[model samples]
Target: MKTLLFCMLGLGLTACGSSPKNAHSNQDELAMLVGTYTNGSSKGIYTFRFNQETGTAVPLSSAALPNPSYLVPSENGKFVYAVSEMNNSTAALSSFSFDKETGELRLLNTVPTLGADPCYVATNGREVLTANYSGGTMSVFPLQKDGTLAPADTLFQGEATGPDTIRQATPHIHCTVFSPDRKYIFATDFSADRILRFVVHPNNPIPQTSPEAVDIEADSGPRHLTFSPDGKFAYLITELSGKVIAFSYNDGRLKQIQTITADTVAARGSADIHLSPDGKYLYASNRLKEDGIAIFAVNPENGTLAKVGYQPTGIHPRNFNITPNGKYLLAACRDSNVIQVYKRNEVTGLLEDTHQDIVVDMPVCIQFGNYSARTKDTKN
Candidate 1:
């Protein structure tokens, strides 16, 4: 079934280190690494090499796997963890060894998630955390010496309570991420519409479990979160309301400070959210109502967002990613089957289309890998 899907998606399994001349200039830096799932019956991972200089991306490698949806590159850039979004009732985390020089992924090992349909994943040091949306829980697993995941050591169940009974009757964990300081784990539940916080302890019996933490408003449908570079504030994207909420962070406690709609009164639909590396700009994408990207200027002192403007992207932009250099933003238009590139105007906090689009099937997530000076030396 998966092989048939890959064929339908037109994703060819190719070798790496053969990027085009314009796509492989020694002076051009590695800007982004986008991941897309195979369409139809396809099941595997496909990675693209993005050149920051020309705003062009070349296909690097395609590896067959099982429904790779969400990807999390390790902080050190040595490993990438991807979730196999399946309902096997025993979903697993698949590990890959990444080649910085060639942008190739070597499958390492896999460990059961102990839950179903694990969609989002995050890692800190030796531990990997995943949010099981269909299972209504979050699970924590340890990374082995060889990069495979260990059996889940902790599971945090979601609580059900909200006005929207249809979608809120059952627990649905959307995303799990760590605080900038790595002291707390924040898991957003779409059904409950609350962000659940957990304290971390490396030596605890279950390092990912914490019962004493605050819960935010119900029915807000918190999806993703980003912390200020200074670690003084945290911003959350609420899917239900199509708004961004800002909160003050003091010693791991997040206090709601403000909320602003990501779209104008004339716009609708929800998408992913991200903050600039300089902490001066916030970018949010919309999936419906004339799909586009929303830009905002961040007030450093109060942590508030001021609307800048919106830029049209392709259809159904499910996720987008910013390069490590902070010069470009890439949108993954799932419905359009193309990844659109945009240049970020640092001064004005706006995005201008780069006129470069990479074709793929159901491209859902975009993630960047750090470029290494060592890799360049070895290549030369």
Candidate 2:
């Protein structure tokens, strides 16, 4: 009779073994690793603690750094590089040490941008690249071991020579980014309507000058550029012309393949462009047409794009980021002072508003970092 009772208990345990609690536990772990951003005052930087799961954010601390507009994390996630959009002739890039555990930022050092009103920055390995919008130049800086930025090593002044007085009066280097292979540095010049590419040397702090830069169509005003995950194609968004151009990239060369209007309506423009991690979707932000995001589906075989409709964001979505897991998107609506959240549909390449927003003053950027395994194991 005791053996019979034991056999019955084992059968019961095998019949109902699924655990809903374990599924919920995994979801909770996902939310803890999301990062958050806050606006530094016109002359400062703000920090925040991010709850990755529920899209909740809270201010952590603030540091005074003049006109901080853009932030780029170091390769190791230990430092954040920012640009001060100062009109002063000596505007610079500032560095901060980031506490991954606390989401706090401590001022590290500043490096001269060698240009005025430096607006955007990007990090490649141990070097920092900056684009000065007002000064029409690009600069490269070395990153020190302790999360500080060394002085600028290379400065390239953009030149504009055209008849279009309104748009091409002078050079405006708007954005700087590196290729996926880290072999080339690409800088988008708005006033010059060109995408300049430089060959990067492993030991050099600055990219070596290359004669391979590609000039886009006149008055297109290329603002931001990104490559597909496979690096087979490149996409560029123009701020002035409201166009999204696709190019075939082969062996570090770009050849224009197609151009489509980013504007759903007749005359609107875009601010930024980003590719989905899976390389199936492309997104561009429209600022003039009442704050909307344009979605495009990429054709893998030909590297072309098809319209995937648009979604309305908050007012003036200056910059946005897709979470690492590709589950959510956060848009930094600069004017509304809110970072709006959206759930992304992987199958359809569409976004649905989550109705959850993080309020901060003049927030302009959003980024993500993965939590360490030890922290995850302990359930932080």
Candidate 3:
């Protein structure tokens, strides 16, 4: 009865035993994982078959859970970790084992995030980390051999406040990003306007190194950070200021080199950031007044950004990602209830809308994984 109720609750959100077979094996099929806000039509994590060659996608299956607003797959693509962005004590982190052949996600376990409204999750196959937004903390969970979480080791954000009276009243850790080498974890605090780095210790339950930090401009609201494919450069996108800060990374240190304007919309709510597979271009999503993606040309020599173009998107494009081959870019529009697909121009590094969108309620985060050896790229 519980299973039946779950299916009913998801309704059009998921299909039972309806995953597609491995057709066209000659072509590269990558699994696209989408995590959504579940207040509306969305149920939980949605899976799809994305053809790397054709740049097309088809829905596969869905896992019915609470608001998994952000998700990250294990390095080996065997397990996925998701955050339940609920309020207060209801917030939690979930683990699932993925089946590539069937495009299914089997629930492994659930554990409290030790914080509230966890907005981001990351894992290096050794431990899982979550950035809890409302609770002003971060949590680390050691991975068991069976791909389940042991207990959580929480790290308090340690008293941070920004200029915004209401939004920056306290520490709000927006994202926990793993370094390219997987030896360090960086957490961005939106309300705090700071980025803190922690050393990873597989043997120790807590973070080490006293946690080095870099502060942003007052009220800039640092949201998310991404690294270049080669890990030589790091880019941080700020929400309030709508600026992209370029940094040179070495060992485990980040040094700011440039700050460029990406989204200057009246209600600047810049969200996610990513680089193309080739690392020639960068894209940042902006919300509120003008919902679109800002395209910037990455200076390969200096690690700076120059505004190239902008593509208007559905609504509230909180998160988006590029394909492994860098042929297509998908935007998960949270308010528009669809994932817009766009074709990439290799020579110019601009985006052209394909008009092919996948309809799902309140889709926010998009990730590409469960890849075959031929279509896999570990940069993201």
Backbone clash count, each prediction separately:
4, 2, 0
The full ranking of all candidates by TM-score, starting with the best, is: 3, 1, 2
lDDT of each: 0.75, 0.72, 0.83
TM-scores of the candidates in the order shown: 0.89, 0.85, 0.92
lDDT of 3 by residue, 108-157 (tens): 99999878999999877778889899998888888888889987866656
Name the candidate that leads on TM-score: 3
By lDDT rank, best first, the candidates go 3, 1, 2
Residue-level error in angstroms, candidate 1, position 128:
0.5
lDDT of 3 at 97: 89
State the TM-score for model 3. Answer: 0.92
- After superposition, candidate 3 runs with Cα above 4 Å error: 1-23, 373-380
lDDT at position 249, candidate 3: 94
